[model samples]
Target chain A: MMPAAVAEPMNTGTPLDKDASQADLLRSARFRMEREAHWRRLDALVTRAEKGGIISLSYDETRDLVEQYRQAMNSLSVARDISLDRALVAYLESLCSRAYLVVYAPQESLGGLMGRLLTRGIPQAVRRSALPLFIGFLALLLGMAAGYRLFIEDASWFYTFVPPDLADMRTPEASANYLRSTIYGDERHEGSRLAAFSSSLFSHNTRIAILIFALGIFLAVPSFVLTFYNGLVLGAFFGMFAQKGLGYDLFAWLSIHGVTELAAIAIACAGGARLGLAILLPGRRTRRAALRHEAHDAVKLVILAGLMLIAAAFIEGFLRQLVQSPILRLTIGWGMGLFWLGWLLFSGREKKIRRGRS
Target chain B: MTKKRTRKSGPRIEQFVPPEGVPVNFTIATLGSRLGAQLLDLIITYLIVFICAAGLFYGGMLPVEAETVLIVLLAFLFRIPYYIISELVWNGRTLGKRIAGIRVININGRRLTPHQVTARNLMKEVEFFTPLTMVFAAAAMSNWGIALLLAWVLAITIVPLANRRRQRLGDMVAGTLVVNNPRSVLLPDLVVASAASVPEAEMFDFLPEHLDIYGTYELQTLEEVLRDPARRAVTAEIESIARAIVRKIGYTDPVKSGQELAFLSAFYKAQREHLEKLRLFGTRREDKFHHAEGANADTAADPVKS
Candidate 1:
């Protein structure tokens, strides 16, 4: 008996023309017969690779696999173009894509990834964002100056600039003792108090940074406002403390954690502003393209900023309340500030080493 | 007649052709499935945090304050590492994506990079989680905060809806797509033998021109029509479809109404062979659109030429 053909007619319609149908059947049968071995071989190789990664294959096997993949892709293109068999075309398409991913996908080690990100990714992103960072700083400074001028001129300006819930230390009419207590906290319960403070501060700062970065898609206005508003609150509190003759103490207290905290916020704002600039002034690129290009750096900046906030939270929680000496606080604050500056500047620089032969 | 024309002309499947010439056929995942995957991931994350918190509480090793601090930090920072590590390890599929049978792929055809994974997952913090936080924050503040938060949520939600690719804000920003991973099995040759014994090819004869009129895409559609048991039961519908195909291909010989299905079956077999032969020669046709529109017109003018 002849091989029962898969394409058997559904019903007893008009008898098919035997000669033409037999010839067509022979062509299809021959086509499948010729290609079946290679197709089966490719399928087995792919299945094995999928089950136990490409690494399981030997070098020669891997080379042979790639050659098979190329031949299969050619088969798929040809099958798609000329073959009328849907099932055949579908099978080839699936095989080719799976092989493509297996052969072409990249694999990297964790240590290598960390090294590249640290050495090249974050630093380059930061450097690229210098202009936006500067703009963020300027906006903050302007807000601070405005708040200071307004508060010094009229005490009522304090209410406008600083929300009452957030104004823990420098509330109007608070005595010096109360102000000092707010900063140092109850000395006996310092550990728990600082932990709570740090957690809350971290959450607050991280949330704000994320918001600024997220809002940057809207042309940066909201980011600018939030940054300026943060500066205004800082200035209002400063003015209040100076008015109460605790200006030096306030500066000493803030310096320990404020440098890092402020820097993180500024960087976040800068990241947001960068996104805004991309949308507003896309240069030669389309708006979408510009936004996509800048978004990568902006996201990196936000990640860096988030890390900085975490560090600031650690310092604010553990170190700030425990240390009482104003001079020590000053020293630690300046040291951390300088350290960050130096790290940012020199961390990723490539150095050429000179060697002399004996 | 209208039904046949509509079935023949309508695009049956979605195809994304990348600019980089190599045809990668990926099925874009629906938003509902993607959201379902995210929901699963969210539940898993919460469960992890809950288990850790319970363990810390029962262990009694640390002070309450320290335990609370640890739990809070874990809750906040856990998602970042969870997403980054999973995607990097599993090649753009988290446990959630894996379970849902979807994967994140670089839309531009390059290998998924660590940077792209990190960027997309980090944006999720802003796009999804932070907005919920903002809503809570808004409840504490004036109406302006609520308005702002609502707008932010709406903006992110609308992005995926507006795009044909169904790319979320994170996907657009990161240049990735979530596609249903193709799952196919080796199929027996459709033209292989079956139980029914009908004459193989005498019902119809297709000229080269008739075979050339349609590419593999249309061929697949035609195969689907022939395979449908429901359509086969309705002889009137099948006859109409066969007639429409004949008309479109400009067959010169009139097909008897009774012979329409048989003609289609024979044409299917012949066209499959013709296409396979063409493929062996290294020439390819992507779909009907890939061929110049005028070729069918030229073939129609010279009906007997094939």
Candidate 2:
């Protein structure tokens, strides 16, 4: 028995007859318009074929051409030898031609491209690394608690060995002087090369922080270790400073930039951890495939972290050293830190409300 | 040139023959399969991510803050690119999906497009956070209960129940479907063979504009079957036949995979002509076979007539 031919419903929305209304086509078109599968296939074919010389149209060009074909089909009263299906095929071919044009188009502005990357790709990357991002935040909080415990507790185990000469790592009077210099901006050091060098060093350190976050994906183990090391160093630095009565001075110096810088560090670690997980245990996928998958996710977090580092560096240079009042420094530092944490956890990028409206 | 015959007889729905001799799964059986597969995937993915993060934490390379962020970030990103690349390169089945005897494809059994993968995975939050997931979590509370429940919901609700052969919520939103792919046959990891060198269009018999009807026949048939949304097992022979016809005259450019053949057939019905020819041939051959047998039977019954 011969298989039967059934005229399935057309998704084009364009009526074969002259009397077909816009609403008629629109009803069907909604399904096709929103059909990612249809558009995606069309996009792939057009892009792939454009790699060859056969299809050479750009994205907009292809979209316009396809629209035109649909319009042409709608205008016609009778079905000529060319069926609706045939007309669609022609439009797809045109679309492919346009995609090819884009593939072969000349490379454009880096700044513009980078902007697009940040605007479009970064959010996706952030979303992908959300798991690690959350965990990393928790780790940051824990690390801070650990630092407080190690530095503030007078009877802490690390401080058990008391050397008479090491009793004063900082002096109360010297700390007060440093605090004054940080807040009032020491006129003596203004416009000096030493200030410039210090600022540069601060910037350099932040960049390194960004790189650590980015490269953590390459090797998960190292990224984790580096993050832990930073925490340890921070604990030791504060502990040593406080023992000598310079804790107030250190707070004024660190608070301005520490808020943003510390957040960036946590974010970077999250990005790195995202990549490492894909590598260490790929579930059912081979390690290579999992790694590649994880790396893309990590890259997004790294970029966001990079932005944070830049912000931190600017604050560290301009505000940290200039801010002499320890109380003021504490307020600003804690406020910024709290704001960031709140944004990261509950800002909720769902944007579903906007989606539902559309 | 062979003229393709149209199957124009009135609709006679045969008791829907299961394709490729595969059994039709009932609702219970299909749901069981989907649920089982989801659990497996969830366990595997979480374990991998947790272990890696733990190793990194212990290694001391990742700082405490970084480790916390890493955990949150990796969990979400795990399925995004996995879905995207697998759909594009591996034709929708990740290694996990392949192991579980399921794969994601277009509504019309075609290799997944990158857009489809991105769309489906992007909306993963919806599936994971769907009310159904919440209900399931309440039913299965534990430390990993929420995550495990979500994983199961994805497999159960988003995956096509074996009986319906339609879409799960994720598939519906993403415009993709999970099909049974026993052996994961991937599209060639196509290299940019002609990257700077634009190969001249090979001169074929058909011109780009002239082949307007290109894949209409195949496209129309595909659309018909897909509209019904039945999860019918496609036979290898049928796949080849459809693909060969579509490739020969569907578009000016050639398609690479059988999945592509099925895909193009939905949008372009020009290949319907070729399909008609196959139907005609099958019918004619069957008639001839019966005729010869009848003649042979007559001869045996009466030798003089022979």
Candidate 3:
């Protein structure tokens, strides 16, 4: 099975057999001897590169290493074509495989990659995800309406929509005055306590956003449901305040930071949706192939959302209560939204335009 | 005595076209090995977590509330991002993978970028731990909802088995492949000790009848013996194999007691020389049983009819 040619009954005593066999042996042996040093050299360089990275090799050696790999690959092809010793063939194959990882793998610094992903990769991915983002945004709005209607029909639905710790004094039981007081919060604890609260919220939001993205790998419906459910919780809180004639007041309280925060969540879910939709509609490509580019795009969306959440948390922590006027709060919130919309659409366009022109 | 003869165990090889466009064969890491590597990583992570908790509990330096918070935060910090940091720093190898002699690589032969590494490792959170969280969450749910959760976990578990690539969810999303890091040295040529070069070495002469009885597999086995480092130290294996070849080929020449390895070297050269001649005739004798040279003849047709 390893042979490249047909099999025949041997034992021909012709004198030509010995000379031919001798020539073949010399040819194979000489073939190995001529390149054995280079193969061995490649083996050593690859080992060092793998263990200590490409920096382990000097400039001349690095250049020599590629040449050695090319030569070894040539030897492997020759050996296979001529059908040399099995062990020799295996050795060459192994040496080449090991060398390939070191020789051809990405050798660029990771810092530059991060810089690129942030300024360009993130926006490019976000702009490409307009449909999924819209779908996610629609789901959240639909959930908000459903949650508000449910809460009005039965105040007991409040507990199901919001966690007890987060609900704090905003529950159905709390008086309107107390609910307003909690919204403005206590200015006395605005130093460390507020900072701690902001950091915790930031981490929680980031964690939830990432989870939505990860769960999207399943088919995207989970991410959609989760995003909708998140909106429901917010709606329930809004409804509880509105029932007490504090709806406008609470909108001002929440909107100061809610716009960016909510959009971040929706964007994160859209990232996950990118993956789920790929599986749902792989088109001409296999699900795996379709996922290849989408998964990366999804990660960028998640990271962008994460960065937004950080900004939202800082605004929520420091600025929301400081600016008490309802008009100013809504203005700040809408301004952040406009800023993001502009950034995502326009950040990475110039490079593409220049490239096209060139 | 019919000794156990093991054939060359061919592992799963995938052809990767590197940047230079040469198709190189990479031996894919098997599922068992990957599982073992993950298990090692989990064990190592938990050990650290356990050690931290035990120290904190015994120290009694902080209040129980503070201690609890610290323990939970420490475990989360260590367990979640451990894989990403480990793989990124080691350039696709965690300590566990390094120990297991396997490493992750980009499927399309590109460098494993940080984005791919981060996304894949983050996926470990979903694939492995989601079920644990789901168990508690589903406990309050109705029966059908619980069943749905179980089905989701089962589907995730089966993804690796769905393909020959053995890609789990993380690998699928990240576009990475795991392969065994092969290690080998090009040993000296087994044909160097032929009769033309060293008379003392090639003491055993192989007639066409003797050479034709075995083929490449047997020749390679003979080469293994000749090149074996312990061939001189442990005479039994070398003697037995040499004796088997001599008896099978009807090699009448007496092999000197100390020269069993040398005798193997000589027969190895002659057999290879005969096979090479056969190769020139476009007739490669694959093994002793390769005489079924026409259609419907498989490698399993080991009649041993000789």
Candidate 4:
């Protein structure tokens, strides 16, 4: 266990200390003398970065900061290896961490991040959960079919399926003409409280989407149920409209934004479902690691969902009111739906090939 | 892992080995300190929410719809972003953490990313706020519901206790760590004053045979005794210790009257050089009583040849 350096002198350099402790101190003192300037410069730069952020530094300073940071990091390792001066080591540790914070911090700027997320991040995430996304889509479709059947058998079943707040004017007892006017908005909602209700509804929908995704972490049952329940409400509304032979008109009206809106919620639910299933079947990874790994993609999908919802809200608020023709409305609805489907499916697949080749 | 917590109540040391292969050590923030920081953050966030709510309800400056929207917005807009943005912009410190001298760092020794910050903060909604609200909201509803809510809250509360790193669910999921900020001061170099540093005295020297009698423990004791600020008035104490060391080591040198300090300094320097040359470091030595064991540790502590 013992080194024989004690029996034989391993004093390779300058001389032994007037003996050892002083010589060792002299070595560290010399170490400090050689590198103290860089540490001091880095400290000042880091203090400035902390106060104002990386943006405040000049280009030259940021460059210098990185060079000095690496120098400090190197000094830290050397100090640990040879020096026993705890205080010097501690100072170097603090300096390196501070400088590391500045240097390795998220390097993408806001606009850059946005561009990447929209172009690659969202689509890639949505693409990864293709199976869950399809399952979510099927859940909504099945719920719609179930609601339509239940309402056709008995109009009174609407109350059981559709909550009052969302039911609005499309009641079973309401006249066909009145229902038509509400769908087409015959000067009723315009110049009125449209702004208030529209914003409120937008916020409500987005909150529900986020909640669906958040609740997915617990095994995705809640998310799936909520998505199904929402589908039922929509189907029940369509069923009531069909009773008056305005089914086609209602489809057109809903399609203007419903395609985007429904799909967004389904995507969000799919994100949650991914998280939920990750907990149950984490595969080879630890449960925590699997969940975290899935969560990264899931979060990207959530962001995509929120953005799509906003896009849907704009269409619902504007195009849904202005457009009267069912044919054109259906076209716009299906067109937007296909756009998202194609984008999510194919947008980022060739990202590697397209990148750096140019 | 925490064998490094040598004192009964010392801060735990966590080491991170970055890709550069330099393993740096950081002092993990204590649980009590983290709780304090959380409490401060909660207070700060609540104040912000309270201020915004007050302005919305009492300001009487906006239309009814706008006020309602803003009041609702306070929950979404302020509290969540306060934690996220502060951590992101301040490089892993919220105002509370900055004040408490702690920071969130990536466990891998990388810089904190926005995604990491965002993930951890978002989990706060699920981990802390939701459980807390469930307890308060369900308390009046049913005994069963209250019990379930409390259990949920309790489970999350004990998560940090489950690991040596004190990571909560959020921290685990996000791969971040909260550590005590490094102590930040470069101390002056540690060198025993040679006779040249003082006026009118030349140095004393000791041979390896004379130096080898003492180990690191005694060297440290000698160092403290000589470096003590009040040594000026304790000349007799210094002289006695010097004479005792000379007698023990059997050094054949005679100390001039006032030069006991010089003799001890040289012996101290020589003894440390001897111990370090053997690579006996970092509390591996006690005193001359265990010179044999110290010798064993010296070879063990030395690095193997590459």
Candidate 5:
């Protein structure tokens, strides 16, 4: 059966003066009758293509599809101008858009997509974002040094910088044993406790990374501030440990997972800074256009950062607590850091082949 | 062709003027609807997290450590994938957005990519979740944190209100728009029965002046009124509308009370024909008001006073 509205004739009630409306209806009815077959053919082709792939159509069917699409577009224009039927006009609009997607839109396979993202998309995006990444890292370092100096000068500065819940190890009056227990956790309940700790830490870090990335839109100030704040906390902890002569031990402990965790946060901040730079100094492109272009690379960096955070969580939870040896902890930390640096530098680079001609 | 006016207020109606055809406007979704859709999505995300946590605890598949880790990971990660996957699969519509009849669309008319979806949703963490966390988790300890969180929330909310496009920070940053999905109802053909029943003189005679007062858009609207039985139920209301139209078009003929619907129907038909005829000659009127000044210029040049 024909669709509900398309086949139905217009209800132009009898009147000689209203004969023009009747004539218009008759014209519409004739137009539909003449072109309905082509419309149906196009609809069937589109439905098949939508369900499977447009490549599934035979060569003749493909040719016919194009022909039918053009005819439908012409019919739509005519119907839109002359016919006062809203439903008919709407149907044509829907049909034309469907045909447009099938005819013009690019289709990609899942395997091809994954391959592209890994090989070219993510690495290229990261490489492009180098400037912002460096800026974010510098801001973090500045904050860390400032925080460390301030806390060392005034012990009370720790409370102002670090939230109480997160100040587990660095509290001024806490005993050495209490600080050690907070660092290594309890031996008997280590497994469960570490699990909870790492999980919470992962969530907190992920939340911060996302926030850093997002807040870059407001001229990048909040993102820079947040990254600096993260650095300040780390510095405050280091300063407090240094006073107790446990700075080296704390360094080793943090390095176990800190390499990956800190890099992830830094990468997220880089993404945010990229966005902020786009808005602040769009240069030749319009602000909107620059933002759109930058968003592509920024989003990729954020995704990579998120993946790194998961890895960090695993390392922090299980390995950091278990590996009590300072040398082993430092070795693992440096090794992982080198691996990340190497991957970022060389993972997707193209090599020139030397060919010998005989 | 009339020059387009620069919009200065309300959510931007992104006008899709096809390369060779008339402009079609898609209005950005209102804040109320967007909030409702977001609330639904948040509830769904919460439920999923709760279910997974419950499953991990009850199943006892792993030790408490592994379970705790897994649940925490799930809590942090589940919502992200939920949004990203749903939008990717459904082309910018999550289950909640689908239910609320809104969909995310790239304003530049390109298909929404996965990266765009990820960017917009990730920004939600900054715009919504981060501040929410501050308010709920850290409000008691720091008044500064509370103030900052409140300001962040207020700024994001106000951004959409102040912008012409109703774009929140996420939308602006990601360059996406949430819009009401176009819903087309199958209107029954209005010309079939009316053609056969009414006598010749019963139809109102529409002069060029009466015909010029409306275009196809208004004609279609009048057709809808005529088609709906409920609209015709109140004779007085119909008569008033009919009278208003008559006055607007400077139709001096007196309309009897019962004949208002018939007059509307007749006028709709004449206006439609006039507009279509104008279109045939390469003259297009977007609406009656769109060409009023142009029409006035033409009338002034013609030296015809009617």
Candidate 6:
């Protein structure tokens, strides 16, 4: 295959042809010469490929050819000292050197998009990678439950760890009332209209979610420690009901929406952690270069997380209420995750430009 | 199809020759190569810190705070020099890049100049600011000022990725090139039967560096072989010998086609035959050698006519 040499128009030098009118002669002659030169490079590439006994030259060769080809085009002259064929050959050789760059060329930009998804709204309508959410959801379910068992089970001292209002809500009677209000979406405030239970939960959950995103950026380690800590607290919170024989009811109440919400939080952690790793490691770039490289990828992970949060919010508001079927809730959550995964792998209109060889 | 007068006096432009430069290994730009160098720098900094700490603890010399400050200062001090020296001395690579088969060079395949090295390294500040803003935002959340700073940093970070050549702020300023350091692979000769009646290009005892003279001689010999039927069978043999000799003399680019080699072989034989005739006709050895080996072979004095 002939490698394409990206050419820029020449500003200096004699045009290949001298006979045409002076005004347009340089432009027209240069164009004609460049076109011919381009073709010649293609021929040379084919010959080099045959001689080298390789189907294609390495990416390095392709890149070099592109630069050389462009330069040769710019340096075109009417000296007749060099043939068009030689110029083309030199250009193609340069292009063959750069062919490998095409492979990793888009990684930085793609990472950027992923970062945006984790931090901002990625529109549930938009497609996203499913693996991260699935992993996150699974971790939240298993990890939080385990952490709660180890840190919060049957420990009266746990009350001292939380605020009085939150600790008071852990009592059996308060838990039952909270569950009833969450399931029916019918709890009313004692004072203002804004004091509806659903609105209160919404405001509180949004604040926590925002906190998670913000914390993730400082350094990945602290955010990670905090995420696991939250999981432990959530586990202990639910364990109180389990000990009272209300475990199944508690599961049904939280699992309806926690699947998506917790997954988003985990992904956000991963994004921030990625940035921290970039700083600690930096590899071949300076600390600054390494950070920039990692930030690009971390930002993309965060963007994906944001989309998951939006999905979680919808489930929390709508499905958490009037949907007592644990089986149906699990199925719907899993289905949404699958759809997101499929979309991420297959979104966007990818343009494939295949040039026909002469 | 424009009507034009064909001038008999004018030489054929298609036959005009051009000079070729020394061949060089082409390089590929890669993040892996770029990243590997960064890792090496970090390791060096850490190692230096370890050494200083060890000296203070074991030798009982430097104070604890002094050692701590020294470590901090060392890490900061190495950043700019590490980037510039490695890029200039080793071509965008450190020990790791050298091991990974990558090097930094100019886009023109030349060594990076000092000015180009300085320009690229100084721009490291931009890349630093990109994530620094994010760190500030995350650490001091709820501060609108921090978020604004983060946004400013993000804007600077995006510029390098948006441009072609995948250059970051530093790369744009430096004009240095990061390229693949390919394995040192030597091209084997496409051998043929050695020249006999025609004097070998190597036998001329001229410096091998003069490839243009040799290339044109071979081209002329190929024309002669095509014109004469007797030389056709040995044409490939002659061309191969000439090619091997030309390449040995550091004519980096060689004719890839077997046919082109054959043509070059014939051109060499014809030129040698012409030289032999001049020698036989009582021509001066110096004049004959000049006619045989120098530029403008076609315009050389024809001894037969004299």
Model 1 stretches with alpha carbons more than 4 Å out: A1-33, A36-56, A154-165, A168-170, A190-200, A350-358, B1-22, B55-62, B135-143, B193-222, B225-306
User: Model 6: per-residue lDDT, tens digit, B34-69?
Assistant: 666656666775687678767777886765545544
User: Which is better, 3 or 5, measured by DockQ?
Assistant: 5
- Name the runs in model 6 displaced over 4 angstroms: A1-143, A151-153, A157-168, A172-207, A345-358, B1-306
lDDT of 4 at A37: 88
The TM-score obtained for chain B by all candidates, in the order given, is: 0.63, 0.41, 0.75, 0.66, 0.74, 0.46
lDDT of 6 at B266: 30
Q: Provide the TM-score for each candidate, comma-separated.
A: 0.78, 0.35, 0.81, 0.71, 0.81, 0.33
* Candidate 2 deviant stretches above 4 angstroms: A1-131, A134-187, A191-203, A342-358, B1-306
* Per-residue error (Å), model 6, residue B74: 48
How many residue pairs in model 6 have overlapping backbones?
54
Go through the candidates in order and give each one's C-alpha lDDT.
Answer: 0.73, 0.47, 0.78, 0.73, 0.74, 0.46
Give the top-scoring candidate (TM-score).
Answer: 5
Q: Write the per-residue lDDT of candidate 5 for residues B75-160, one digit (tens) a residue.
A: 77655667777777666778788889888877765667677778888888877776766767874757787777677778888888
For model 1, what is the C-alpha lDDT against the true structure?
0.73
Residue-level lDDT of model 3, residues B1-306, one tens digit each, is 112234334566778876566678888898889889988888888898899889988998876656655665456556556787888888888888988989998888878888888888767767876666778788688999898888878888799888777788889999988988787766656665444443455345566668767777777766666666776458898789878878888989788787876677666666776666566545556678655454334333323112
Docking class of 6: incorrect
Q: lDDT per residue, candidate 1, A213-274, as tens digits? A: 76777788888888998888888888888888778888888889888888888888898898
DockQ for every prediction shown: 0.33, 0.03, 0.32, 0.24, 0.36, 0.02
Q: Could you give the C-alpha RMSD of every candidate to the true structure, in order shown?
A: 6.5, 20.1, 6.5, 7.5, 6.0, 22.6
Instruction: Judging by DockQ against the true structure, name the best candidate.
Output: 5
Q: Kindly report which residue stretches of model 3 are placed more than 4 angstroms away from their true locations once superposed.
A: A1-27, A81-86, A163-170, A187-199, A316-332, A352-358, B1-9, B18-22, B43-90, B132-146, B187-201, B221-247, B253-266, B295-306
- Cα lDDT for residue A71, candidate 6: 49
Where is the poorest 10-residue window by lDDT in model 5 chain A?
A1-10
Tens-place lDDT per residue, model 1, B1-306, is 232444464322334443334575767788888998888888888899999999999999988888888888777766566787888887888888888988888877567877678767767876888776677677587778778778888888999989878888678667888887666566655554311233534556666777777766677777787776688678999888888888888998778767777677777766665555555554454456545544654444343222
Docking class of 1: acceptable
By TM-score, the candidates rank as: 5, 3, 1, 4, 2, 6
Model 4, residue A16: C-alpha shift (Å)? 22
